[model samples]
Target: MATVSEVGELLIQKQQTITSAESLTAGLFASTLAEVSGISAALKGAFVTYSPEMKEALIGVPHILIQRHGVVSAQVAEAMARGAKYQTKADWAVSFTGVAGPDELEGQPAGTVFIAIIDDHDEVHIAQGHFAGNRQVVRQQSVQQALDELTNLLSKN
Candidate 1:
């Protein structure tokens, strides 16, 4: 099975909840987690903020961070994850932001995705993935990577 389902099973077993803040992948990351059976036991909520203003206003990403690192950078993804964790009161939170298209954003290449996760211990992790595909493929790969990372982190704990 895909890692999202595995992550769901682990989260259920551990009784941990997760929330999500999405940008480039939109809600694909959250939707993948929700696709797993019995995910409600651990799934908290999912927020789709595609715009920088929305990322800042909805997820509480700092304006200064966005100004410095741009919305597609790892810093914004980290802040978004942290903000989602606090906003949803979930044990863990994740954020996905980047350029997944035929065009570039803030000078970053397309298919560049930054996935960030905040564990229950308040530890944050970020990963940057470069994919070669259309918009759909990039989004799908990003979701898979995020789920895989979540599974790996859970294994360590």
Candidate 2:
């Protein structure tokens, strides 16, 4: 898997922009990219939508979709990616939504996460991960997972 810095460098190399819609990992994915020098060329902006309401309000993720799939499901993750991509007009958009805590959410155990990536063609790719760790570790892993997925996608085309 590629590191966050590698992902940032790839984005700059491709001249591709990216945005994020974060829930479980908060804004960690974007912040990690920000740590890379000159990442501003490809890093667009991010929405820290920790709540379902904000997910709907800010990105137009339908409430019915969330109600049906739960906040941590793959469907919500894809919607988040598509919405973020549309809103930001970025070449790529990554979304993180999950349970990362000592408590379960919607029957999902802690460390259960759903990540989605939307490419420039409007194609969506989703992944569900079960990471094992504490809350902070889970969050960090989720961000890394997102970066890895984006890096792989970038490498493809």
Output the number of the lDDT-best candidate. Answer: 2
- On TM-score, the candidate that comes out on top is 2
Against the hidden true structure, what lDDT does model 1 obtain?
Answer: 0.91
lDDT (tens digit, per residue) of candidate 2 on 19-134: 99999988998998999999999988999999999999999899999999899899999999888998989999999999998999999999999999988777889988999989
Q: Give the lDDT of residue 94 in candidate 2.
A: 94
What are the models' TM-scores? Answer: 0.97, 0.97
Query: lDDT for every model?
Result: 0.91, 0.92
Clashes of 1: 0
- Which residue ranges in model 1 land beyond 4 Å of their true spot? none
Error of 1 at 111 (Å): 1.0
Q: TM-score of the candidate numbered 1?
A: 0.97
- Residue pairs in collision within model 1: none
